[model samples]
Target: MSPSDQVLGTSVEAGGATGGDWVLHPDRALPAEPGVRALAREILSAVSDLPIVSMHGHVPVEWFVENGSFGNPAELLVVPDHYLVRMLVSQGATPAELGVPTRTGSGVTAEADPREIWRRFCAGWHLFRGTPTRFWMETELVDIFGVTQRPSAETADAIYDRIQAVVDSPDFRPRALLDTFGIEVVSTTDPAWSDLAQHHRLAAEGLGDRVLPTFRPDAVLTLTSPTWIADVARLGEAAGVDTGSYAGYLEALRLQRERFKAAGARATDHGLATTDTTPLSDAEATRLYADALAGRVTPEGSTAFAGHMMFQMAAMAAEDHLVMQIHPGVLRDHDPAIAAAYGPDKGYDIPLAIEFAHGLRPLLNAFGHHPGFRAIAFTIDEDTYSRELAPLAGVYPGLKLGAPWWFLDAPDAMRRYREAVTETAGFFNTTGFVDDTRAFCSIPARHDLARRIDAGYLARLVTEHRLDLDEAVDTATYLAYRGPLEAYAELAS
Candidate 1:
């Protein structure tokens, strides 16, 4: 039998005043005024347990199939998470020592011990303080994993042992865990070169017909990133076109779209520094491709190649039934040393001031009016929510605004997102929350936060009589399930 924790622990010595498990008392979550809090609580209860519809996220499919005991608590929770790693790195910890993967075919995993990593991570728990990562980890440890005593160096061994014990059971496996979390569907990201054999295997084994893939061919379009030539060649082979030429390269991309479609891909994802899209004519495109092939493209030409490819992708979506997702404004791997030691996502990517107006013009102009084309744009720049994103989605027929992403994916962020987008674009113009995380176990936590925020927001609406309780219930359900299913259904199966 698996170890199960059933207590909401509080320790005066450790002081629960910290944000993690301390952010909200179940009762305190209601509101300041008793009557208002009660109403809010009632509203929140309506959507608390809706089945999760994860339209976007990142978790290895092997977790569901060969679900083994997660090696260690830190490996399960901290090491792979940049949200955790970046914070740790900020405190002078080195990624090399934290088992961060290396790009030069070497990895820090060699000399690292899981317990040592957890000890290091635990010592830095105080750094989390009021941050959302602190709150979520605290909740996961206390509320979910049954770790009552705050994680300090003293508690590392006990905590890891307990968590490992709990996870060793059949109940802790991926399918079982998803069941425990009431997940109905989960969409993972895959590159265009991916064969998706694992996804097919899981679907064949009957993982409740929920697990699926999203086609993310950023490596194909991101000429600035590594593996560009290989990615392009694979694109050509998949599409049965010559990738050596600009025209053939476009065909290769189109063919990969069909391949992903056949593999149950419902959407395509792109990671960019900005939402600004540039389109190039045939002549300009040919020149850029030639430069890229020759490894002589200037930085400006490289970025333009990405922008031009965005337009071409939109055109491909017009023909195929795939939804398009663009995750923009992240300056990936800002730390030179950490990036040198560890590859992409070694906890140094920072968000930038992403402008939607000028950045997205080229692609939007090309397909903004074309019916049957859907583009969902995501941004970490909260400043653009009401001012740029809401207004753009409000007017564009083919564009649907994605929710606040990455750093802005917390409960407060979700609430702020609704307040930001709903007034102008309205709820229908916005796709519901996508977890957008690589932490598999945290998917439930992310979605739960979104629902709680939505419920809390809708509860405010109901209390104000701006929305009826019945309507709030329906909307909550939609935000949790129907919205994602409708948004990504055709692309999946």
Candidate 2:
């Protein structure tokens, strides 16, 4: 028997192979009914070739700047992927076993061998059954890397060898892969204190506006963090301003945003456990800032300060024309032990219930009608779709509901999102879709899944006599391509 046959545990056959070899059905995520499936196929075909406008994501800028080969399959696909690492950890796999890097002086040694990590992941592949992770991984394996065999203990070594060869090829370089993936513009989330050296390097190479940076100021804004003082200092140095006073700190943040905008940034991202945007009087703000700088800030002070900063961020967005992207209600590092051992993003962050109507009213009241200001709000809380978020987006001219994201970026959840928001908020009041991934290779797969789910939803709408076939195709095209472009129109400027 051939090695491929032995590894896949099946004999090769004509037309299509069976048994252990991985096969992605052409109708994978579509509606199962014949009539709806046919309509979905037509709708999907119309917009499937649109270039991906990944306006919000976590792919590192260094990947594009360096233009080097991926180290190995495990590093590219396993270690940095929280979606995969979280599932493996839940199924009795250790982060160290999966080669997740630990913090400095954490004394926890990660498994150093890439092959061993790959073996551990392959053995636990069943844990991802019926998950979005599995769907994305399968697409990456079969479509991107041309792997025909299923991942299992028996096939792990063979699959890894094949993937390693592909990673070593010059075509696998990050810049080359952008063309392969059809990404028109991809944004990297950068800290408030970033000097944007990597971004300048890429821009100087004439890759202007293709790769953009996003302003993320969570560390400097959170007064309760242990490193907040140092982070404030870094922000001051990066912005060439003093941060010793509250007024100076605000100016520093404004200057940083201006720097990001000059470097091709179109948005600022804020992640919080709550959605509070209450503004404070200048006196109160100065007092909190002084307390924070003196290391005497209370828990109440921190919460108040963060909410005030949210209000300030929105005001800044209005003046600067940078679209604001807010994704809140996530309690980071639920497991303290894992966080201490393996730092953050090992998938311990869990979602909490958030109230958007009351928490965001102050900010909306201040600038929701301003033509220059625009905000996209995302939530894992499905309950808010039709209740709070949809109604708010329906009325507020400056606000648009973000697509299903993070934990809610699955097939059923994506369909549910449309059902909940399309009534009140409608299609134009929403941003099409944001991949929001650090897993660079999975961007196309994630976008494809969203497109298929949306087509299926639009197909059902057509069959229900709500929308005509032509209208469905138009809406599908808008959701896939035009929505992002319109929402982030400043990018074109």
Instruction: Please tell me which predicted candidate would have the highest lDDT against the true structure.
Output: 2
Which window of 10 residues has the lowest lDDT sum in candidate 1?
A: 1-10
Query: What are the Cα lDDT values of the candidates?
Result: 0.75, 0.90
Q: Which pairs of residues have clashing backbones in candidate 1? A: 20-135, 266-491, 276-359, 276-360, 277-359
What would the TM-scores of all predictions be?
0.90, 0.96
Per-structure clash totals for the candidates: 5, 0
* C-alpha positional error of residue 121 in candidate 2 after TM-score superposition, expressed in Å: 1.0
* Clash count in backbone of candidate 1: 5
lDDT of 2 at 159: 84
**What is the alpha-carbon lDDT for the whole of candidate 1?**
0.75
Cα lDDT tens digits, model 2, 204-264, are: 9987689999999999989999999999999999999999999999999999999999999
